[model samples]
Target: MSEDPASSRQSSRNQDKTWINRLMSGFSSEPKSREDLINIIKEAAANQLLDDEAVSMIEGAIDVHERQVREVMVPRSQMVVIGIEETPEQLLPTVIESAHSRFPVIGESADDIKGILLAKDLLPLILNGTEDFTLEKVIRPASIIPESKRLNVLLREFRENRYHMALVIDEYGAIAGLVTIEDVLEKIVGDIEDETDEEDEDGFIRKVSDNEYVIKALLPIDQFNDEFGAKFDDNEFDTIAGILIRAFGHLPSRNEHVEIDGFEFRVLYADSRQIHLIRLTIPES
Candidate 1:
């Protein structure tokens, strides 16, 4: 018996989709090595079969396998932690301020992490106004991973164990940083902006207020100038961070401000090394 041509074509299309999903999942029976899979993906991208975002995500997935936990985990200093002895009153404000779903419950300091505390777990207690709040009651054992752990392996463990956040430890068995499911996913799918992220129409510069715009320091200087209708020289620097560093003559700390070309560039958030977020205010002319 001969098969229907239409049915055969539909089956072929389904097989292709399955193949693409397997590639996306980073488990293809045909492509044994990373290079082989990447080459196939690049060929597909070059042929315009896969869109740019899809190609980029596929490339990111390959890169994730090559990366380690330490490379992607949020630095220890930047981690928001809840004190083990804190009352419900104190904890409520802290949770609201950070807007974080999960926080590490710490004993003496950030290094002395007790366990993971889910914000949702405290919702019922808060609603009932439970004065005698016990940290041990709500805290759950945290999953710990070595900084040297491979992303692919860690991701698999995360799925198997249903772990959302993991405490990354160093060679000394000290809390080095934190890695979340979101962080791991972002490594593949790129930055996942939250509801709090106030991005503008362009999606580069975010609106902070009537006159203030929170801009990503990585925005290209040319795009920055074009976005705000300002004249900023891109000859010496490529990105907004580059220009700011040039102007400051050193790495600017948080709250540092520089007025250039009628724009007030204030460092909304920064570290000793790089500016993460900047608030740019353009006075109404």
Candidate 2:
């Protein structure tokens, strides 16, 4: 009338294989669920965590997921391209001030993107006595992408294809803008400091008043620290736009507003699906 003690004992003895089950589960051999695999890998990675790499990788992934090429593309209105018949002397200033390493060489309109020209090419040509240089001779092949393509994909393509510049195309197959590898990388990392940057303790841009505000998403963390007179680590994000996106869980649209660390973010305007223009209002530092 009692349970089988010997059978139960043998079953318990066989239970010695539980660790094997767990080991196989780690490799997901038993048709396990999603969390099992995720948990196993996550735990393993956590156990062998590398701080700097993990931080960079995490931020990189977050940055990659949140960005679209359209957000960072140079709108057609601002594009600087060379006409097939244009002289170099007239184009040098435009190219120099823009600080772009390369630009698309096109006809009168963006639709005619012929190729890309390196800004540095002008220096060598000028030094080499080819002052009448036409971009048609020096232009390199250009890569094109859809405006809807995610920034991550664009970055990957740029690397794999070994192209530095891209022409952003809209759904109608018209050039909407341009994007460079630098622009795409800066979206994930912070701005690459150049000699042109002016470091200020009050931040690069600030609010003059409540209704009118200034913002420099490139404002350094030290400047932000001084301006706000607070200590906050910018580990997860670098730009104000990144912070806003994280807070909103989506792009901030026209007139949308959110407050963070005593600063107010008002979406002035953005391109169709991304945050292009934002006004951050903060007290004078």
Candidate 3:
């Protein structure tokens, strides 16, 4: 005899309810702290109740609540800005080389930010000709935000206002850095690859100059050794980040540097959880 589909569906719903009830029962009391909540979620994953991705995302969401804009912002020194007085011909190379959709347009100084310029807004000028191009006519209002703003609050504003970028200002109202919607989302989820990201081995380690390189902390120790020709012991730690964390004896914050075997590893981006990016400087032989 064939089983009834309706009966099967009802049975499946009952099973799901039972599983949920069992999971809820395990949390006998409310989680006292974020760490406790994370521990419970991790235990649930260990027991096959929740998946690894779900646990990671939950932890990330909690992390966002504690982080500030300054922690994840692109530092002012690393920001690529377009001078307000620059002609279309002069800015085209910067626009093409940086491959960024939006740029902060500056006036007399870097602190004197005028407005934000969209790359697409310049297409008409390129098509028609730069003979009549005026930056003020094309630039849009800049979204200014404070460096101390929490990431959760910033993310909400980004969604509600439909703005992708914001200029971060310090206590003195100077341009400290810039933050984007992608930067906030990356905290919740993992890295989101865009068109500009290279898909080759060089993608993990990008050369900034003859002595400096930008590297992803997730890059394997073996791959790092292959690139730099260093003899790092990969047996103890799988990734270079692990080795660095061990060397630091604690989680390192952004801009923190440590020297090992004459190589300088400077933290480019990191949170309470782990390091994301690092800048490597090779000592001259």
Best TM-score goes to which candidate?
3
RMSD of each: 9.5, 9.8, 4.1
Which candidate do you rate higher for lDDT, 2 or 3? 3
Weakest ten-residue segment in model 3 by summed lDDT: 197-206
Give the TM-score of each candidate: 0.64, 0.56, 0.81
lDDT by residue (tens digit), candidate 3, 1-285: 998999999998887777677668657777788878887788777766789888888888999999999988997878999999999879999999999999999999889989999999998974798887889999999999999999999999999998899999999999999999999989888889988976765438878889999888989889888888899999899898999999899999988999999899999889767898899999876
> Residue 177's C-alpha lDDT in candidate 1?
92
Tens-digit lDDT track of model 2 for 95-128: 8777767878888677988888887767777467
lDDT of 3: 0.89
lDDT (Cα, 0-100) at 48 in candidate 2: 47
Clashes of 2: 0
TM-score of 2: 0.56
